[model samples]
Target: MIEVPSRVSVRDLAKVFQDGEARVEAFAQITLEARPGEFLCLVGPSGCGKTTLLRCLAGIETPSAGAIEHRLEPGAPGAEQAMVFQQHGLFPWLTVEANLHFVLRESPVPRQEHDAIVQRLLERVGLARFRRFYPYQLSGGMNQRVALVRAFCVQPQVLLMDEPFVFLDYQNRIVLQDLLLELWQEQRQTILFVTHNINEAIALGDRVLVMPGTAGPFAREISCPFGRPRDVVQLRTNPDYQRIVVEVTQLLRQEQEHSLREGRIG
Candidate 1:
């Protein structure tokens, strides 16, 4: 696979939807950047356009305004930018192993190397024994992990994930979070992960970008003071972790309160 620059820049970005005669602004003037191999997490209230923003970054949705620039090498798709939605998006008919292989179909990974790649990923997720299980046969967390494996198999330079584990139960979610950090440490891809869970955001991101509830710029940018090689279970017990959570929760509340005063949101 070809290596490409992982830096992503979004400038004066905005997304608006036309609801008949009404123009609904999904978000506006959103500017941010994620450096190479950086894990940037986005947190926002419902309808704040976090998912929409990710879709735009993935080239799945066109923005209503502004520009998103990726400094990829010319003639390369930047290790082929990959996006994972909240939905597993896996083929139900395909077994877990088959699903991972499916994504490699268009990837630069040689067909002969596909099996080894899949083997490594499945083992990493501790799902090697269940490789033949279909999506319907696996739990939500397992299926989501498979989805993660699928994305990583492509060896994307930039990974945009929208609430990939939001639907899972707590235990599964933490395990996956740790697994994700491990995978990311190995691949060092530029990751932009969206989550409503602030603790999850704080646990995983290098910096947390809050989209907020109002019609203005982002609420705030909070840096995670924790060092890398983070353990989800251990992170929660730290005093700094509690402080950061309070700080983020307050910011989101401030945004929502401001929106309420302005009558922008309920």
Candidate 2:
């Protein structure tokens, strides 16, 4: 198989925040590449700047230093990137279908084409029956599914997710993960996901990037060589999957210890 170049590249990325009279360094010299059609997860302790990194990639926030270059397809209008947050950023006043249609309408597509796209996405996310239902009528997981479909409908080249499944219950999270994988396979969009959950990251990511702490330049990168169309049930019994999870868990533990040591010193 021939190797393709990275779709997105970040070199020497750094970010700083002003806290009172002092300058607080969040991360420095962070370098990473997101290859085409790869699911990359950024995992670390809370406040480890994972969300900030995701924001930078989404163009929601600018990096204090370094460069991020998105190599878009020829003739494409800018680089299409979308972000899904932990909160379901849905409009309460709009119905499920209406919420999706609202986003689609913003695009340059004709009204007829936009309607078709919104209908298909609603059905795809298993919200066809809830199309007329408002956000308050849907459960937390269902609302999140709407959010995911809303983002996917735009056909973004890159999807930036920050703990999108964090609010769901265990069973809901599992179901949503499977649905997300299905959508990802169907769309083949490059994804950069941030999560504190190790198992979730291991299950979803083709490569996991682990950041050490809030002020981290990511410390480690682990590749998941397991074949996909990955099944949650089968993964529990797969030795390779188990081994990688163990390795990642160990790495996280080490980071925790390092964080504690730093805390004591400070």
Candidate 3:
């Protein structure tokens, strides 16, 4: 049986990078939590430490201060996490099927089931036909499809995504957004997605956390009023969606002004 989703908690989180008396504080004095199966989106201007925070949650980077906890449902199996980056970090030498297998080498999934897991997820994403194809042989959008399936194949407890579709054309972005939501609806993993697109954040998230312009505590936490399963294309027509867009935009505008006053951004 699949382990239930985990709840994430962070207390007084901070990250600082130092090099020979040169000190850079990525973010500091932060506190947040993600409820089980909740889709959380992080939004901010560039260099607000969004990615740094995500790395901490994924256990890739250690925080300079504070605590992070991934508390799974009682009696559930152990937790697993996966990440999808803006770049499709697939090996040119490996075909799509092989790339998925490579990730499972370090994953908890059984070796005997690896082939089936890869095949099922690829088929779910309509990428089964391209399984033997190399990443270089695929379009940027198709490679991203492979990347999405690869991340989901492990059925991670926490899925960290960093602007995975930012570079795609509008049409493909929308299509992939639908695909991602469809997969998440079934997989129900706790997601922490980082994106600059306000619409994307609101459309995909249950709650959106807006960060300050510079490295500091988070700015605002606004709950998305939309009900799921959401349709991204039709979401714009909803009055509340438009209202939330304006609301988040206003909050971001305020954050930019604050950054300007603090000399954090020019």
Candidate 4:
């Protein structure tokens, strides 16, 4: 039988980057927790350290201060976390199947299990027919789908996504959003998604954290109690969804104004 894993705790996290003579504080004292099977969305302006924070969580970048602790089960997969970035990050030379298999090959599982995992993920992402196609042969949205499949094939415990759907057109975004939701439900992975789109955040997240301005940490956290299997059409018509969107937009506007004033003062 399979056992459950613990949650992720991020406490007093801070990151600073030096650009020549200037010291830029990207984030400071960010405290948040992501429970198992939770969908958390981080929304902010263009340079509000959303991606920086994601990098910290992924262990790709060490924080300047504080801690990001992953409480996983003993002998588990070392806090399996996979990231899907704005760029598809696919191998142009390799076919879709090869790209997915590349990620699976790094796992400790036996070689015989690789084929099953790759095949299942390809079918789940609607890429079975295009498995032999290279990155250049697919559309932008389809390439992003391949990236998604690659990320999921590892069976990560925590999934980190940074603007994964920003490049797609409105129609494709909606379709992919639905497909992503279905995949998330099936996998039950703890997901932390960063996006600039307010509507997209509300549509995909169980909780939304808003970060304002180009500096510092998140300004506010909003809990979305909306039920699962959310229909985009129904949510657009829902009063609660509209209210939260308006509120988040207002908060973002306030942050922008604050940043402008500070810039002018300096």
- Tens-place lDDT per residue, model 3, 190-213, is 999999899999999999999987
Task: Estimate, for each residue in 1-266, the C-alpha lDDT of model 1 and write its tens digit.
Answer: 97644489999899998988988788999999888888999998777789889999988889989999987645543255788889899999899998888789877767888899899999999999999999999989989999999998888888999999989999999888988999999988889999989999999999999996865578899999899899878999999999999999998887767666756544
Model 4 over residues 1-266: C-alpha lDDT tens digits?
A: 87554477898888999889988787788888888989999987666688999999998899999988877645554227799999999989999999988777876555787798888878887789998999999999999988988887777888999999999999888888888888888887889999888999998899999875746566899988789888865798888999999999999888767667756211
Give candidate 3's root-mean-square deviation (CA, Å). Answer: 3.1
Q: lDDT for each of the candidates?
A: 0.87, 0.84, 0.88, 0.84
Residue 201 local lDDT, model 4: 94
Clashing residue pairs in candidate 1, if any? none
List residue ranges in candidate 2 displaced over 4 A.
1-3, 76-79, 108-110, 214-216, 264-266
What lDDT is reached at residue 115 by model 1? Answer: 92
Error of model 4, residue 240, in angstroms: 0.7
Task: After superposing candidate 3 on the true structure, give the runs of residues whose Cα lies further than 4 Å from its correct spot.
Answer: 1-6, 73-79
Model 1 misplaced stretches (Cα beyond 4 Å): 1-6, 73-78, 260-266
Cα-based lDDT at residue 199, candidate 4 = 93
Please give, for residues 133-154, the per-residue lDDT of candidate 2 as tens digits.
9999999999999999988877
Clashes of each: 0, 1, 0, 0
* C-alpha lDDT of residue 122 in model 2: 78
Candidate 1's C-alpha lDDT?
A: 0.87
